[model samples]
Structures are given as structure tokens and as C-alpha cells.
Target: MSLLLDGVTVGYRGRPVFEGLTLPPVPAGSLVSVVGPNAVGKSTLLRSIAGLLPVAGRVELTGESLTAMPRPERVRRLGYLPQTLPQAVPLVAYETVFSACRSALGSWTNADTEAAIEAVFDRLGIRHLALRRLSEMSGGQRQMVGLAQVLVRRTPLLLLDEPTSALDLRWQLNVLSAVREAADAQGAIALVASHDLNLALRFCDQLLVLTPSGRIAMGAPEVILTPELLASAYGIEARIERCSRGHPIVLADQALSTG
Candidate 1:
């Protein structure tokens, strides 16, 4: 399984966010992080791939054209979690997840659907929240439920927009670990849009950086996350250092003035 984007362009009111964007084919079981400063089109990129936006070119998955596929078929193959938190509704966590599971896997037996929901809740350590109402939960808790909704679908491709944004450090690690495990075990591809460079470096197999001037860089974190890249992409004077475990970490010293 692989995902390819060729000459993909997305915009609002004809103002292009991504103009003719193309990327190398992403193989299955790879976890890629899309990182860049605000308004650099990270969300737009994921949205286009998720078939939620209009595009100019081709988006293919394993030789099938996602852009041309029927909406139901495309949704079955791709799961997307937006950056916004799940709505605070009257539904409890378990009920919400069950609804999501039923919607995606309508043919599944009730027992199987319940089993999947339980498994995802256990994996994400959100089982305790199962009985809690969404309206009573915090933003972070709601975010975790949002993720569980996607995870239970078992789609071949996951597009998560800042899945860890509202999560604390421990929960952030938990979320990324779960996502990584899902990708590896299912031979699926996950594209996560994140602002946290450190977590991306630690958990992602590849990094897709969007620069302020509209350049795109894709490679291993060590190869693509250089001081120069940071300056150009984020307008920061930064250093890429290695942690104790040899993971690359970005150390920002100062922000560079655009003027």
C-alpha cells in the first residue's frame, strides 16, 4: 500500500494554499509528520488528501485514484481527525465511539463492534472515561475520544491533524505511541500534522516540512531538520541537537524578524 500526490493544489476563493504540490510515494506502515509554521498549509495538505477539499491533480492510494473514488469508498479507506475537538454533546464516551464504529463498519456484528470500541479505549487508556459524558469532559479528554472514533474504524490510511495538541506530555506520548503501533501492526500509513517538532522527531519515520516560501522537504528527520531548514521554515535561529538517546531535538534560540 502506498499514497501518492502529484500536482495537487488546494485553495480558498482561488487563493492557493498548496500550488501543484507533489510528494514521493509514501509506503505503507510509515508514520510521517507534517510540520511547519502557522498558515503554511499543513491542514490544507491533509484535508486535500482526505478528499475534503478540491484539488487540481491526482491523489492515489495503492494504484487507485482517491480523487476520483466515490465518497463512501474513499472514506472506508481513509480516516481523518480534524484539528478541532469533538463536539461536547449529551452522548457518553462509549456511546460516541460505538456510534462511530457502527457508522464505519455497518456490517460488523454488535459484539464485534463493541469489541473494537473496547480495544481502542484500552489501547488509549481512556476506558475510565467511557461512562463520562462528552459535555463534562475537558478539551483534552474530548480530543482523545475523537481519536478513538478514528481508530475504531481501522482504515488503511489515517490523517490526524495535531492529535496531541490538547494533550499533556504523557498523553501526547500515549497518543503517538498508539498511532505508531496502529500503523505498524495494520501495515497502514499515518500522516500527522503537528507543531511539536520534538515529538515528531521521536515517533515519526519521516518528516514533511513546508517552508514559508512554499518549498517542501521530505526525508528522515535527521536529513531534513537542519538549522537552515528551521530558519527558513519557522523563521527561527535554532540548533538541531541530539538527545541522550540520539534523537534529534530542535533548540530554538531566537525568532528571526521577517522584515
Candidate 2:
């Protein structure tokens, strides 16, 4: 299974963020990070793929046109977590995740649903927070709950917008690791929009870079995370160095003057 975007165009009020944006098919079991500076359309790209925004061209998944699929079918095949955190409701974490699971998988029996919920909570290491009310949880805890809500759905395609933005360093690693594990276990395709290049390089199989000037780059981290790409996309004079574990890391030595 794979996702293909062909000549896709998206914009707001006739002002195009990107036009004719196409990419090689993103295969199942691959976790891709969409990275760019602020306002470079990372969120817009995810929203477009999630069918939350109007688009001009083809978005197909395993030969099925996602743009033309029925709403329920689309919902079943894809799960999206927005940049904004879930609202601080009076509901407990378990209740919030349960509602999301039931809403997405209505045919699942209660026992199966609870099992799935428990599995996700365990995977996220949030079992302790399950009974805690959302209003009582910190922003990071609530963010984990939001992710659990999406993860419990078990959709084939996951579009996560800044999934770890509010997380601490350890939790960020945990969240991305969980996401990567889920994608590999289920043969799912996960497109994560992140500002943290080091984390993306470490966890993602591929990187989709969006430059401020509307350029797009997609490849393995080693192939795509170059000094030139960094200078152009982020306006930073950065060096790419391999970590002790051989993972690529970006070191921003200086910021280029935009003026």
C-alpha cells in the first residue's frame, strides 16, 4: 500500500501555498516527517491530504482516490491529529479515547474496544493517566491523550500535525517511537509534520522538506538533510553531523539574515 500525490495544489483565497506539488509514492510502513519553517505549509499539506481542505489534483492511496472516497471510508482509512490540542473537557482520559475509538470503529464490541484502548494507553505509557480527568492533566499529558485517541483508531494512514509539540524530550522520544512502532506493526503510512529536525531525522524513515519559497524535497534523511537544503529552507547555516549511534543531527551554527 502507498500514497501518491500528483500535481496537487492548495492555497487560501486564491493565494497558493503550493501548486503542482507531486511526490513519489510513500510506501506503507514508512514514517515520514514533514519539516519546514513556520508558515511554509506543513500543516496545510497534512490538512489537504486529510481532505480537510480543497485540492486541485489527485490524492490516491493504493490506487483508490482518497479525494473521491466516501466520508466514512476516508475516515476509516485515515486518522488526523490537528496542531491544536484537544479542548480541556471534564471527561477523563479513558473516556476521551473511548469515545474516539467508538466513533471510528462503531462495529467493534465493547470488550474489543476496551482492549484496543488499553493497548494504546500501554503503548503510549499513559495508563496512569487513563482515569485522570483531562482538565486535571497537564498540557503534555493531554497531548498524549489526544494521540491515544488517534492511535486507538488504527487507521492505515495517519496525518499527525506537530504530535509532540508540547511534549518533553523523553516524552517526545516516546511518542515518536510509539508512532513509528504502530506504523511498522500495522503497515501503516504516517506523515508527521514537525519542527524538530533532529527528532525527525532520528525517527522517520523519510523527510519531506518544504522550503519557505515553496520548494519541496523528499528523500531519506541522509540524502535530504544537507547544508544547502538547511540554508534554503530554514535560513540557517547548519552542519550535519552523525551522532554516536550514526543518526544524522543538524547543528545550527548561525541564522542567515533575511533582510
Candidate 1 ranges with C-alpha deviation above 4 Å: none
Stretch of 10 with least lDDT, candidate 2: 97-106
Cα shift from native, residue 78, model 2 (Å): 0.6
Candidate 1 local lDDT, residue 151: 95
Query: Model 1: per-residue lDDT, tens digit, 2-117?
Result: 99999988999979998888899999999999999999999999998998888889899999999899987887899999999999998999999998888877899999998999
Flag clash pairs in model 2: none
- The per-prediction CA RMSD against the true structure, in angstroms, equals 0.8, 0.8
Count clashing residue pairs per candidate. 0, 0
lDDT of each: 0.94, 0.94
Candidates in order, TM-scores: namely 0.98, 0.98
Can you tell me which runs of candidate 2 are displaced by over 4 Å?
Answer: none
lDDT of 2 by residue, 159-217 (tens): 99999999999999999999999889999999999999999988999999999887889
Q: What value of lDDT does candidate 1 attain over all alpha carbons?
A: 0.94
